[model samples]
Target: MSNWSIDAGVICFSGVLDRFTVPDLWASLSSWKPTEKGYLVDLSRVERVDSAGMVMLIHLLEHAKTENCHIMLSFVPKDLGTLFRLSNVDKLLAKHIQN
Candidate 1:
């Protein structure tokens, strides 16, 4: 199972982020509106991630764009970073990722 919390304009995620978990998380966040112009997404505690998780991250970025907000992802897992590079999507998300 996976879960997320927001504090001080940062969204922190923990546990596994896969196909099963992404659906519920996505549903919950779909209607969320950001109150800040800039936000940070901290994934350092996330144990694992799959393609679905990557897709969800992209969707979150798009959602933020629609709201005229910007979200930077921080502490991305090594494996997920590899997946992004292998999938050739690293460039697309590079500007939004913070090492």
Candidate 2:
């Protein structure tokens, strides 16, 4: 049901997070100012995550921390979740990339 949608603090990424990904996420994330404790990461669209993509997200995470904002990813696709887990990146990843 959720393919692409956004609110003030939520980005419903509902397709794929591979290759030319994360930039869109960056745009959406930069669309507004951080005015609260947390935001959201709708990875429902993110189907695959490569190293480059992960790097971008990690940068976002670091920036978020310095800014004192947060992102919570919900409903990540099954395969990507496995990929994330397999890469052992789940530990270093911030809280937003989880359900």
lDDT of each: 0.95, 0.64
Tell me how many residue pairs clash in candidate 2: 4
Minimal lDDT window, size 10, model 2? 1-10
Candidate 2 lDDT tens digits, 5-96: 65777766555555576666666655545676787766656656666555656666677777888877677666656666878887766456
Residue 7 in candidate 2, Cα distance off native in Å: 0.8
The local lDDT score (0 to 100) that residue 43 gets in candidate 2 is 68
Q: RMSD of candidate 2 to the true fold?
A: 3.7
**Model 1 misplaced stretches (Cα beyond 4 Å):** none
Regions of candidate 2 where Cα sits further than 4 Å from its true position: 1-5, 22-32
- Candidate 1: tens digits of C-alpha lDDT, residues 1-99: 999999999999999999999999999889889999989999999999999999999999999999999999999999899989989999999999997
In model 1, what is the error at residue 51, expressed in angstroms? 0.4
- Each candidate's number of clashing pairs is 0, 4
